[model samples]
Target: MTKQQIWEWFANHSKQILDFLLFLALVSMGAFVKILKQVRQGAKASWKWFLAEAIVSFFVALLVYGFFDQFMQTSTLFTYVVCAWCGSFSTIFHKRMEDLLGAIFDKLKQLISEKKSL
Candidate 1:
């Protein structure tokens, strides 16, 4: 394709293109976290861990992206922030998300529950 054709095609699908880039970036960052941890532990860098983290990051990004698109309003910045946070730091993010969700559920359950006797 010509330069103009490529540019037009990119413009038409910019959202998909950017989202994929975000996913790859998150995967790289996530995998790199293993190196940092290993360094802290006085160990050599492990390709096995890197590959595992990258796979986890990809799946996390995919899940967040799919859910955000399906359930939330389409805001590119919000989507990017959420995907980056959760994908790059799955363990921490998962714990935090669990707490946040628990708080929300607790509030909802409290609000919907009937009053108890004294």
Candidate 2:
């Protein structure tokens, strides 16, 4: 298709396109929050780390979307790419958190058993 054809198509679907982008952004932000919680754990929660991660994720996402908007004309495909990246990162973050929790639980159980033996 010609350049005019593409521009016209984008114009017609601009609202839907923007809505999807906003949705992806919201989901990514929510995932970041969950990851932050996981990283906190029991007494190791650090506000500095949390804020740093938040800032980094924000800039990274913005840079990615901006690059795509400037260099790529396929908005739908770009949306899917963002969604996939965020979803995968969130899943991995959750798994790591689960592992951390399990380790903490195991340590607690060991402590309890040792106390009982005393």
Candidate 3:
């Protein structure tokens, strides 16, 4: 294609690219909100746990990106895998937090009942 034709095509598609980026940003924000809700529901709000998750996620992301850069070198496939892994990991982590919260609640209730009967 001619230079003029390439320039015209880019001009026409720039808005679409911007819109897609905005959509991705919104999706990320939504996911973060969901994760926060799960963290809040846990038995205790521990900074240690938050820090650990952050560290793990950072290392995981770096490892994946490095591996892809070294071998696959396919941006599209790397993005897809990262998104899928992040989504699945978030879901599992949230469920585990909920379970821990439930267990804590049960124990607290039992303790209260025992105290009331004493």
lDDT of 3 by residue, 23-111 (tens): 35543543455457667777345687655554544444445546665677766544545643554256565578799999999999999
Q: Local distance difference test, per candidate?
A: 0.71, 0.64, 0.60
For TM-score, the strongest prediction is 1
C-alpha lDDT of residue 114 in model 1 = 44
User: How many clashes would you count in candidate 2?
Assistant: 0
Q: List the residue pairs that clash in candidate 1.
A: none
In candidate 3, stretches whose alpha carbon ends up further than 4 angstroms from where it belongs are: 1-37, 40-43, 76-118
Every model's TM-score: 0.54, 0.40, 0.37
Identify the runs in model 2 with alpha carbons over 4 angstroms from their true place.
Answer: 1-24, 30-43, 80-118
Q: How many backbone clashes does candidate 3 have?
A: 0
Model 2 lDDT per residue over 5-85, tens place: 999999999988887777566646654665665666543557785665555555445555566666674575555567445
As for TM-score, the candidate ahead, 2 or 3, is: 2
